[model samples]
Target: MARITAGVGSSHVPLLGVAADTGKDADSYFGPIFEGYEWTRAWEREEKPDVVILVYNDHASAFDMKIIPTFAIGCGERYMPADEGWGPRAVPPVLGHPDLAWHIAQSLILDEFDMTIINEMEVDHGLTVPLTMMFGKPEAWPAKVIPLAVNVVTYPPPSGNRCWALGEAIARAVASFPEDLNVQIWGTGGMSHQLQSPRAGLINREWDNRFIDSLIGEGQEARQISHIEYLRETGTEGIEMVMWLVMRGALGARTRALHRHYHVPCSNTAIGHLVLLPDNGEQPGTDDDRALATT
Candidate 1:
């Protein structure tokens, strides 16, 4: 039984990475935006959890736009970082907790949750950007990460409600595991800024705030929202918020948000950062291991 310490989520905009590394977005672009991640360095040093369950949507990478699952989990020992033009950022590959990952996979299937399990997959900025931002770009990553990828690209994506349900199922799966460990679940991407089409660079702060409010406040209902409504109202790209519901559902119903930051104008994306610490209701797990993986 791993105690979930924190939940992290951020947008995977390639432009931000390029700017951060090239030293181009010092003031306007990267500076203010990355402030949300500064807390990550502190969390790693202070609240270092045993494992992190990352929820991000892959964009045309690994699975491609061909056949995508509503939710996919990586059970491999390591995951490769996708090359996003500027080349891989020289970080340790993410490690996966196969035992827990497999357990969730089995439980989800039995509970009627459709998901994909990947032995090998390359993660793009969708998972890496926010990661490096929060944890800082060292030669390698410090902890193990389990990727629970969701599909927000092609049509027929899962609804927000479905994503939240998946989160609840995952929590149950983890709780049932015989082992004890401290885990963190993260959901990344989106805050209402479309990145494609002629109307690119659109920003809807109002909608973004509302989504955040509903996500942290509403439980099952927030997760159960329809995908059609998300796409129609929030724009196609905005549908990514469904992933957040997964993280919200996994955490305690009455979590205290430690920090929150939102910014737009990074290559047509609204970057949202949130850190939720689960309350003292849950008991601590008795486990003894740190996780790290390279894929």
Candidate 2:
């Protein structure tokens, strides 16, 4: 049966995608930010999973105020990069795992979670940026991706608890798959940083680190964090951090933190990344395991 071997959480700042696409990632300002993912790139090369369930928000590219689905799963065959105003980034189109995606959608619906099934939709930076962070500028993404777009852009987004429960349901769905495939669930967006007025350009390093610590440890604290707390402490957009809990919950009750990286002021956002392996009694590697494991 298909199984989730690892979980990854990352912040999908749009500027990061521009920097990479324009070859500015090697420049001084963005170089350090891109460097943080070097370890992850190498690690992923060795632990290549066949399928990745990417959780991200649409950023008004695919969905807007007209129609917004709180939870949508893509069961399409391919997804082109969306043109967010300027133009679509020069990136490879995303190939979807329709079989797995449809299966997951069915399982979640049967499990009492209402999910919108999308047959075709253009993907924005919210989905592509994390792929760039992990796989770099490849002609084609190494893994087949299943886009799971969550509605965190609009008001009254799903609660952290709700997202966490969705993750558990996803794990159950993946386990029931008959295919013997390696699967990875990824949650993207936010550490903290708001774009709106009054408290715009906010980056709470203290709270961000504390949240990362909670996730790396028992994860109970992160799981219990409320929506109001995120807005009050981390900024309005900081609510995006709740998505990370989905990745954490899918890793089961316990997980071994393989690697973690956190950086601040990246395009006015706190860029955070984590690589976690399910705790099944085996020890993790020591060499380069904590290379970029800064909090």
Off by over 4 Å in 1: 24-26, 218-221, 280-295
Please write out the lDDT profile of model 2 over residues 142-250, one tens digit for every residue: 9999999898888889988899899999999999999999999999999898999989999998998888777764556687788899999999999988888888888
TM-score of 2: 0.96
User: Count of backbone clashes for each model?
Assistant: 16, 0
lDDT of 2 at 243: 83
- Candidate 1's displacement at residue 196, Å, is 2.8
lDDT for 192 in candidate 2 is 92
- Which pairs of residues have clashing backbones in candidate 2? none
TM-score list, all predictions: 0.88, 0.96
Residues 200-254 of candidate 1 have per-residue lDDT tens digits of 7777877777676665533446665676666656677888888887888787565
Model 2 misplaced regions, further than 4 Å: 282-292
| Candidate 1 lDDT for residue 119 | 85
Candidate 2 global CA lDDT score: 0.89
Deviation from native of the Cα of residue 154 in model 2, angstroms: 1.3
In model 1, which range of ten residues has the least summed lDDT?
286-295
